[model samples]
Structures are given as C-alpha cells and as structure tokens.
Target: MMSPIASLTLSISDNATPYYLQLREQILAAIREKRVSPEDKLPSSRSLANMLGVSRSVVTQTYDQLVAEGVLVSKPKRGIFIANTSLITMPLESLPEAKSAEPEKTVGYFDSSADHSVFPHKAWAASMRRAWLNPDPKILMGNYRLGFPQLKEQLAKFLYSLRGLECGAEQIIITAGNRDALQLLQHMLKKHVNQWYTENPTYPPINASLTGQLEHLDVQLGGALPPENTSPWAAVITPCRQYPLGISYSSQCREKWLQTLSEKQGFVIEDDYDNEFIFHGRPVTTLFQAAKHRVSAEERVFYVGSFSKTLFRGLRLSYVVVPKAFVKPVLESQKQLGQSASLPMQPALSDFMASGAFYRHLNKMRRHYRMKRDYLESLLNAHLSQWFEWEKPTAGMHILLRLKTPYADDPEISGFLKSYAMTQGLQLSLLEDHYVDPMLATKGIVLGFSNTSENDMECWVNVISQCLGCYFDG
Candidate 1:
C-alpha cells in the first residue's frame, strides 16, 4: 500500500490561501477522515517538497506549525509522525454529501421570532467591541456563578422600570433561554414540590422540560387557579399573555392563584415572556409584582424572562429571578451542571442594556410588530373570514385563528394544512400542537406576524385562501 502521506490528494490550488496552508489542510483532512492514523510516519520536509514540486521552506513552515499545534510530533533523531492526540475521526462513509450550488427558494415562515432584517447590528457590534476592549475582570475570571454582576444589575434595573418588579442582582441567574431557566428550576425544586402544573394550551417545550407527574390547568373555564391540596406543588404560568390564546390573567385570577399558592405552600414559575410587545394598552401587572407583597412571596415565586422573542432568538440569553432562599442552591446546581449561558456575550449585553440600546431596540420592535399585526388582521378579515374567526391580539407576536365550525378531525386537518402550506412556500403552525392533551386542543391555526413582511403577508394570505378553498370546497 502507498504511504498515508502519499495517498493524501494534496494540491496547492490557485486561491487566496497560501500554499503551505493548503497542504496543511489536506493533511489534516486525511487525519480527520481516518485515512491516516496516530503515530503514522510523515515524509520529511525535503521529500514532501520534491514530491509536490513546492519549496522546502513551505513544507518546513507547515510541519513546524503542525508540530506546535500538537498535530504532529517532532521526535528527535527519528522521522516526523502524527501526534497521539484526540483528533476527531470522521469516517469517509459518514461524510455529508456536498451541497448544491443553487440557492433555495425563500419561504414565508410564520414562526414566533423577531424580524431579522431589523436587528441592530451596528449598535450590537459597538457594544461587543467596547466590552472586548475594556473587559470586566469578573467576566474575564469567570467568577460569576450566578451571572455577570453588571448584567444582573442592568437586568434588575430594566425589569423594575418595565414591570415594577422589585429584585436585586443576587436573586437573578443568567440562563441560556426560557427552557434553560425551567430546567434549572426543575432541578432545584424537584425534591420540595410533589407535582408540576401548566396551562392546557401552553408552550409545548414547557411540558417537555419538566419531569415527574404533570397536570394541566384549563384556561378557558376560569380554571387558572390550581386545586388546593395538602401536598405542595409547582406551576409554570404565562400570566402577562397566555401563549397561543393571547389572554391576560385578570386581577381576580391573579389574586386567586396567589392565594392558593400561599395556602398550599406551592411554588410558581412565572414566565413573563414577550410582554414587552404589548401593542394597544398599558402593560399588565406581572405575577411576580402581584405576589411581592404577600407573606413569604420571595420563597413562593420564580420569575422567568428572556430576550429571545424581543431581541433575536440567537442571543440565547434569559434570566430567572429566583427566591432569595434558593439562590445558593441554584448556583451550586449550575456549577455542578456547568454554565449554560455563554460568558463572552454577557458583558456585551450588559453594555447594551446600560447604554439604553436595549430599550431603544424594544421601542422600535414594538412599533414595527404592531403595524404588522394590524395588517395581518386586515388580510384575514378580508380573505379568510368565512372559514376562520380570530380576535386581534393586543400582546405577543402571534394570533390564533379559531375554526368557525368545530371538526372532530381538527388535528388531522391542521396537520394536512401545515404540510400543504410548506409546499406552497408558506409556513404555518397548528394550534392543536400547543396542547398537552391532544383531546383538549381547539381546532385553529396560529400565525406569527412579527417576522412577516407586508408584501409576503398579502401574498401568503392569498395562498392561504387558495389552500382553504381546496380543503373546504372539495
């Protein structure tokens, strides 16, 4: 058999990259693909240079760099060889097929995400650069078990200004996102709480994240209050605006829920996600704010908020305002599990918030999304009224269009519509998919308007009309 080095199809292409780098990549690829194993002998710089018709200096540079990176071993007096390092092995058979050159057709996706076109890239870049140039010693040392202190301080200020929530930096824990916050709460509270409860038509990921027996509270029949039991329980609630349904909990509902939690010694995970996007009216009082004055309120409530919906989702930054008593345990659990939210972006986000860029971005998105929401409502009224009826949402990014006529096969119909919509370059979400129990799900479609453009909205609305005609007329 040919030597492993000789078998590698190394070539110096006429590209921007240097010849030495090109040869280095080809050799690395061979090792990664397992064509060359650890401890395999490599040809000397002179021999490789002669074989490839390149200068000895180029080969020597490549070898020296690889040896420094521990990819190659320079054994004194012996020939150079591949180092016995833990290089990843990607077998040739398992390699993915090369992507086609043709660009994919753009699809009008109605998912709950911020408009990517409006992201404040310049402002964010400035904040990132500032943070990098004047790095905080706490962030650089990675000493923040709870979170970057400056970010926690800024978040506390922002939350107090936005929602009248009284909290301190010590009570806040930076998480990857809402799901990460929920998972951390589950870990910390699993022993004390007997059962977990969520709204019936809740965010599906909430149900997926919690372990142990989970029960659903009905939102329609004024069953927002959990059942009173001797055993202490925990609940995950979206109080500012219910997901999919877009209904805010009334003052009476909030009071009743808090009373039940207090009497039963239960805990609540208040998910105040996307409340900043409220369009028409004044912002509603948060569950955390409502429970703050209650006896032992600090121990009974955990407030969760995230930037994924308000800002771009890729930020992957969320925070949980935990009870004062549980802060140390949660931080300890985070230490054991490893930090979920990355450290580099935390300081940058702190700068963004402190400099008032975050508030400005929120104000801009609120206006932009409100206009999109109204435009979509008008299109649905003009075109899809006969088959569907929807109440215009005052908060959150999406609207739920309930079917005019209840069908027993609603799930199947919605699933079929989702598949059909994808073929026509329009993405749709099934309202039924949001329910914990499929049997309790309402027949509807949830359309996200925040990310959809006016032109795409009109185009997709007509396509949706055509889709409905196929379903109803046939």
Candidate 2:
C-alpha cells in the first residue's frame, strides 16, 4: 500500500514565529488534510528531525505536546502514531482559513514600550548573578506570599518618593505583573466587593480579571463619572497616562473621583503604568495620596505598578500598595492561593532597585523613549496631519490619532487596512481594539513609538502615509 503519510515531510520558515511552532502547525495541517490517516505511523522523531534538517529537540517537544493533546499516541516500542481521527475530527468547513505557510519578513508590530536597543541586559544580569550567588536562605524558601521584604522596602521608598504613593513595606504585595496583581485582588476582595468600575476602553485584562467575581462597570474617564449612579465597590483606573488615548486625567476629574470614592465608601485602584517615562516635568500626583490622607482613605485606594514596561517584559515583577488594614488579608489570600514570583529573582530586583541601577536605567530610557516619541511626532505632523489629530503624549509609549477621513472606523475599512498593512510588513493596531464596545469606538490610531527604533521611522512613516492615502481614495 502507498505510504505518503509515512513519507510526509515537514516544512519550516524563518519568520518571527519560532521553528517549533512552525513545525507543529505543518504537521497538524498534514493531519487535517488527511494525508496522514488515523493510526498512521509517521517517521520517528530522530528520522523526522534529520529529514527536516531541524533539531531533534524541536521535533521531540512538538510530538510530546501533540501526544499530551491526544492528537497523537505512542506505543511502548512502536513509533508515534496519529490518534483515531474520527474520535476528534473537525469538520472541514469548521476549520478556519489557514494563515500563510510562510509569513513575510519585516519588523512586526511590538506592543511593548521597552527599547530593545538600549536594554540594560548586562547590568541586570550582573545584578541577578550577584543576588543569586548569595541569597538569604529564607528568600529561597516559599514562606512569603507578599513580595520579599527587602524588595518591598525598596519599592516603598521608590514609590513614595517618586510616584507620590505612601505605602509602608508591610502594605506592599509583589505580583507576577499587572494581571497577576489584579487576579490576586479579585480573589482577595471578591468576598467583600462585587461591583467594579473600569475605564470604557480599559486594558482588556482588567475585564478578564473581574469576570465571574464582580460586576464590571464602565466609566467614561476624560471627564466626570457617569452621572449619579450608585457608587461601585471599587474603581480600577489608569491615572498617570490612560491607555490608547495617552491623556492624563484633568485635575477636576481627579478630585471628583476622590470625593466620589470618599462619600460612597468605595475604593480606587490607581494603575500608574507609565509614570517614570513622562516627557513633562513630573507625573501627576497620584489619587492614592488623597485617599490616604482623608478619612478611611487607606481602605479606599489601591496603587498598582509594574517594572515590566519600564525595565523589560520578562521581569514579570509588579506590585500593589494597599492600606495597612489590607496587609494581613491580602497576605492570607496569597498564602491560600500559593501564588508568588520567582524565588531568587526578587532579591536580585531588590538589589537592582536599592543600588539605584533601576532608577538610573529609567533615566536613560526616558531620554531614549522621548527621542523616539519625538521622531514619531514629527512623522505624524509631516505625513498624517491632514487625516488625524492628536495630543502629543507627555508620557506613555503610544499616541491615539483621531481619524479625519470617514469609513476608516467602519469594521470593513479597519479590518482591510490591518490585513493590507500586515501584507506589506507594517505593524499597526486599531484604536477600536481598546473599546469595550467596538461599535461605539471612535476612529483613531494608536501608534507605539517606544519600540520604533530610529532606523525604523522612515520606512514605517512611508508605509502608514501610503496606506492612509489609499484608504482615503477608496
């Protein structure tokens, strides 16, 4: 009998995606096409790795994942075989359209604000090595759920001095990142708080965090709160520079929220996401301060920040500053959930921060990011002025451009442009993505400059300008 299935070859690409993922997809495609039948034995891992001219480890990992996923099975001595297809068959019509087997090569979009060009990898690694070499034995143990004490103390000093926060080491809880921080908040506070307010176009993860635990309410942030509704149990807000829009809350709006939270016995979670990179003289004083000073303020304000955006995304080090009253309960919640960060890394981060290396890194990044932001600003002014209007952001990595031409906000136009830009190797995102209700979103563009290196500006600007012009004509 013919055995094309056994002889099937794997194809790979040199795109942004990893080689292992490419291999996985190709094999799955062969299976889906029925070129490899149920119970059909493919080449052994070693054979396939040689045939494909790839690492045996990559092939092994892919096969293992498929085995665990039940797409393939292994016999004691026999080679790996495809699982019975009928048992887990997907209808041909049900399969979504496949992406290009080989994606085009170009600088793909980046969501991070970190400048890869100037990442302080050497400095950070040295710090980690030093701390890892001689960490306090207690830190290596998993007793503490809140952050390490030394790190928390360093964070307390850094936050209080820099971000206008007033949390003691006892009240600080280190988390994996913003998402983990919110998840911990949900599990900890769900018993007492069931109603949460978030910005209309809030970070998508916030919604996911609050789901099933709290009623997520929308707040139209640039102005005042939605008129005279019952106060929520708490409000999760990004105060320093709101996401997508890149606008700071006006003074009046900040005061209004403070007063509202005070009167209604509600809490405010101030997510100071982009505080350190402000192009302006200083960041806005946090609303947490007002909540701290006033009656019962401690319970009413939560300050959340992370080093991921500032230092590097892999750090996964974030923190929340709570009132003294909350320290025990939050820690108890952490204890029960067994959620904590890397054992050895926390001390390294503490050393980095305490040694002033972290702050110094931020200072350098601020200047670098500022330059990139300026480059973007000039490009937008020169090319996109007719079609968009924007407030140059004083902080944050992205700027939201309000669209001038019609039809762009229409689902078709936005969707088409995204596909078109991708085909042409331009990385861009739709402003509509941030809105809770995509239909209600305005026509805008969110351009991230932090990762847009100097060399990238010319090409990116030309691509965007040409795309916008074509969009206008058609």
Candidate 1 wrongly placed segments (more than 4 Å): 1-108, 221-223, 406-412
lDDT of 1 at 292: 71
Per-candidate TM-score against the hidden true structure: 0.78, 0.76
C-alpha positional error of residue 240 in candidate 2 after TM-score superposition, expressed in Å: 2.2
Which of the numbered candidates is closest to the native, going by highest TM-score? 1
Off by over 4 Å in 2: 1-107, 213-221, 224-232, 405-412
lDDT of 1 by residue, 283-359 (tens): 88888877777776657889999988877776777899987889988987877665656566788899999888999
Worst 10 residues of 1 by lDDT: 92-101
* Clash pairs (backbone) in predicted model 1: none
Cα TM-score of candidate 2? 0.76
Which candidate leads the pack in lDDT?
A: 1
Scored by Cα lDDT, where does model 2 land? 0.73
